[model samples]
Target: MRFQTITTDILVIGGGLAALKATHSASESGMEVLVVSKGTICSGSSFYPLMEALGCQAPTEDPEDNIRLLEEIRESSFQMHDEELTKIYIDEIRDRVAELPAMGIPYRKMQGGRIPCFAKRARDIFIWEDWNAIRNKSYALLKAKDNVRLMEHCTVIDTILHDDHIAGALCIDRQGSLFVISCRSMILATGGFGDLFEHNLNPSDVCGHGHILALDAGAKLVNMEFIQFIPGFMTPRYKVLFSEQILGYCTQVNDAEGRDLLARYLPSSITSRQCLDERSKHGPYTSSDISRYFDIAMMKEINDTGCEKGFNLSYDPKLLEDKREFISIYVDWIRKEQHIDLLGTKHTIAPLAQASNGGIVIDVRCATGVNGLYAAGEVAGSLHGADRHGGNASGSCLVFGHRSGAYASQWAKSCDRQAINTSIARKALTERFEHHRPNRIDADELIKEIRHLMWYHANVVRNERDLVYAKDRIRQLYEDFNPATHMSNPKTIGMAVKADHAARLSMILLECMLLRKESRGPHYREDYPEKNDRSYARRLMVQSTADKDIEYRFT
Candidate 1:
């Protein structure tokens, strides 16, 4: 019950590229900024640098190229993106990307010019070859700043609101100690909820707790149904993201039963070679193309066989022999970093949860509609809708990360820090951990259950029946959860809190998926099976009402 109170002008929550960029921008305002992360600073999906590297796309110097890039974004996202935000991204991305070099984070520059990835001709992307160097330099720069303070191994329990505005946050450190962080403004750059699934490429702590925090603060989350699933290794190296670039070279794919996986799933019109070629052009699974069958087959194999290790996939190195440029970079990086020879290895592949394109809705300025609160990066929604462009993930992090921090700082400077009441946070915490029930749910077990439930029912393919089952099961799990019984061990407290957050988020996400009732982007319903633009074109938004009920509406 004992807690310490800390006051700051701004509070930034997250540990990834977005959080670090926000911190850097906020520090410029000369305000007292406190960054709290569940993990170490510079950790999260961005640090992982999947595929070729952590790709960041920006507009080329040519004006026509920029226009084409904008068109490509709209086309690629299935016209589901916010126009205003998309324009802002295209216009400001170049400047934001330029800042990287000054921060000592060097990117690969090919001889000709920008390297385009993920099937976009107009789009030019820069890949960071050395993510560790970027992480170290980013940390060093932020640490050297006088007004910024970084707190690691700290989990934010909930957002504290006063008069329906951001006041502070309730947090707990790695130890059992509690801290009340009062700030004029708070930024949620806490990445995505990929960790909520049974299989994901995200770090252990990268659950969508930030989405729940934003909802609690009365912010609406948009496009919750659009989750990006990528092909990743299920064995040899579990959850290691398999590059889509190399997917084209996959000569054979067979399930444990020796059944040809792709051949079994592909439609009569599409050949295995054609599917692989189309699938290789993009990373995330999309209903927009025939390539979707690649991920669909993988998911189906896992679901049908209940094979935890997924299917065996073998690649032809001879296919890549013609493309030495790719071999030198991607193939070599895999060999050096992952300790895997892509050509020589026969690995198990499955549809792994990669990122969430939909999240807490933010405007052009990255404001989350709620005062004193903002969101950026993967945590912020409406920026990328349906299917996101390949490099836009890291690009949006920089563009909106700076926007959120700068705007939050500007807003913070205009107002005085409000006195935050800890009663609400305390009450919720007590309700969560105060129960003395002898029979209590295990947080770790609950999380595993939730992950399996999500992956099986809600991931890749969904129908009303499966989605409803997921929703009911999540509600049951929530009712059964009693964290107080496990309070004796402080380490488990964070896990317990995360489980609760994941359950709440999972319920909302399921509802959104169910409400859409149409196939669009990553949110494909097997029952619907087709995109219905007339009925379900608009983005779905979810928010928490005053009565503690979730409200959903089409925007």
Candidate 2:
């Protein structure tokens, strides 16, 4: 099939904070921007915001607020993050948030003060509960930009190369139309591979498109080893609802119902201000030493009391009696937040979802090793090194997305247009589609198996054996991926490529994680329980230097 073509000054792929910021910055700088979406604009991981989330705020009144905030995220990153990149995002975080309200994003506010970053708030800071509203507002703003052209419901199959530099991308519409969008520069704000895990909070659409695209384009990828496994948020009944309640309330539910069921992880000295210690790294309470802080006998008694109480404190309004504001919040959550009936019940959450800690290695300007191509958001591994800070994801995406967009636009303006050749697009996309020729393996079935494989091997707990098993399974999947019917169809081919892309991403990260013997933020190993700064202190990246199978080298 011949390619139908459209050209633009700058091409922004993936529609979220990163893509929106990039497109908007380029357009505001007087460059035409064509922004593409993998799905609806307001979907994916960023769609569900749990309260303020990020704590990137600083005021003259609070002398150490900014430092403290930076310290928080830095700690999460295990001090492995790029200092400049972290600082830049932190500096412009509020600027990004301020833009949201101006764009009509809904956020619960009080006396004109907006919600501050992070789930916790001490005093006069604006604490917001409405996050879906924020996402909608950002979407509205992006939709309103004149220079920005929004193309929803599209998937980029592959890049069309010109003299080895990226000239454009080939995409397929929902109705299976082959549309080639040519541009001098491309910005990939494609999110992360969190959907690789079955129980992740990130939406399923975020299946590591950015990593695969960059790999095919020969861009160097780094830190694929560190996939962040969030510690808190284990709900009993639901299939991993967010630990958002704990984020606001500083609560921790049962861990697979172990630890005597009532052994508290919190230290005896904990107050309202000190509650975060239960969840923090330096926190006195932990899974390894559960009995250290809690009296086992007391814990058993409390567990019995909690059981006799019939409803877990999480849902029971009685627990909130002493704190009416908290009661109101609980009432609102029970009434609005949780879909649970007002009838009190105990909810179970365990390591709710995985967050991506690292991916492709990009520089401060969001440029990867490949020229004429830039990656932002989760795809670009610049901000978070070992583990990501609480609110860094959205903030970094907004800040760097804007920077990458501006740079891409500026570069596109100077480069003279070479007629985009159609041969490259057809060949690249067709070969990709051909891999999925249908004989058997239903896309649905294969996808489910892959998810389970990742959940068992790659998510939260990891050891040498599991990681090895995961790598071998991924290899088998790659081999068995052949389809029998309509094998050469473009739509089928693209979907197959997506599966391959996600699988490859899992293998690459898992391989790197397996190689790293030390335990870090997201890449925890049961064998090496302690964080070993001695050997595995540096950042890790896996690049396909020569062959299809990746080779790892540190960055």
Candidate 3:
């Protein structure tokens, strides 16, 4: 069947903060913008506000507050993000928040000259009136834009390249119809790849399609190996993501052995709240002081004894009862309201699984090496080198998202149709159908096997031998690609393309993980236990040089 074709000056492939910013900037720049979201913009990974970890009491209005905090997080990302891009969004985050108020978001703010201390540390965290406000406001912006087109439940399969220039995109709608959308410039804001792991605090839709698209288009990637795990999101029965800001400040009572284990982990230099330095200068300051620093692998053994004790010890029921019934209601609300199947078995959690600290390579303009393509939000690798600070993520959404879109729109405005070719898009769509037909692998089985391998080899600890094992298994999975393996009755040719895009994302992370040998901030090496800042402090980049292999270079 002949598919429908749409044309715009620019196309943004995500519905998250970055895509919204890019679409807004493109329309504001007077360029026609088209946005295709994998799911409803509000339902994707961005909407899941893991607020328990926040130590803030209220949001900050200080103009300089966002900028100062972000510089610190960017320093954590190993100074890879452009300083120019970092400053812009951090400077404008308040406006982004304020915009929400106008969009039916009852933004929480100081009433009549009253400013409550939102968080314990004003510099490290801020309390949103409501995190859900972001999801609600974006709906209004989509409604108001005259030149902006919204394509919901759509997947961008690949780019259309003509003479090495990205000309347009190939997309598949939910109805099994192929659509070719041509745009002078494209902003890839499809977010991160947290689903590559077995248990993820991230929404499954965050498959890092933006990064994969850029790679296939010949753009270089940096630090794909570094997948930052938040120690708090222990899954199975509950998906409670305790805030880093709170843990960095408050005291944690780990009842693994019928009592708090934090006492055993506490060191001589500090005790109680003092042990967690609010002014921690580095990502993982002292190895013993970092996240999951004192090993609690024994806690798993303790978790098994919970069934005999009555109350499951993996998660602290005291957190719900003590924090309040409101906390329980709020946690339950996320599951019922958002379809997060996190309530099954009692699970033990450490401070892990927050935001991804690594992603695709981009300059101040949010452009990868490939022209006409840009990345933003969590998907675009920002300033979080080894680990990100508590307040820094909010800064990134404000900063990098704005810069990527501004540059994408400006680039779109200057281009004509001369550089575009729609052929590459057609090929991507056709190839997608080939992979989805009838398959033996179920999504559960495929994901389960993938999670097991990744978690075993690539979590907080890593060694050279296990990483090699990870590589071999991943290559085998790709060779035996099957889509109908987990058919949800929606398996059509179009969905195959999305799966292809998703698997490539997993591969990218594994490839990058294999190259980096030394341990850094979030990416740990059990074998290379020491941080050899001498040879590894520089950013590691993977460029497509010859044959399918990446050529690694340090900057």
Question: Highest TM-score, which number?
Answer: 1
Q: Residue 509: error of model 1 in Å?
A: 1.3
Task: Give residue 449's lDDT in candidate 3 (0 to 100).
Answer: 69
Better of 1 and 2 by lDDT: 1
Residue 251 of model 2: what lDDT? 40
lDDT tens digits by residue: candidate 1, 1-555: 666888999999999989988888898899999999999998999887555467677777789877887787787677678889998998998888878765557776443333344436734566675777777887888888899999999999888777767888888898878888889999999999999998889998889999999998889999989999987887787777777767778888888877798888888999999998888877788988898888888887777778878788778767557444544567776677777787677678888899999999898789999999999999998888798887888989999999999999999988888875566556756754437544346788788889999999888988999999989987787778876765556556677788878888999989999999889888889899999989887888898888878999997
**Model 1 bad stretches (over 4 Å):** 49-52, 110-119, 324-327, 421-428, 431-439, 484-492
Q: Model 2 compared with the native: what TM-score?
A: 0.81
Tens-digit lDDT track for model 2 on 300-361?
A: 33333533111132333344443444234544564465554333545443343455767677
Query: Sorted on TM-score, highest at the top, how do the candidates line up?
Result: 1, 2, 3
Off by over 4 Å in 2: 49-73, 106-140, 231-241, 244-277, 280-331, 341-343, 432-440, 483-487
Give TM per candidate: 0.95, 0.81, 0.77
lDDT of 3 by residue, 432-522 (tens): 3345444545445555566666655666666777777877876676556675342223345444445555555665566666666766666
Candidate 3's TM-score reads: 0.77
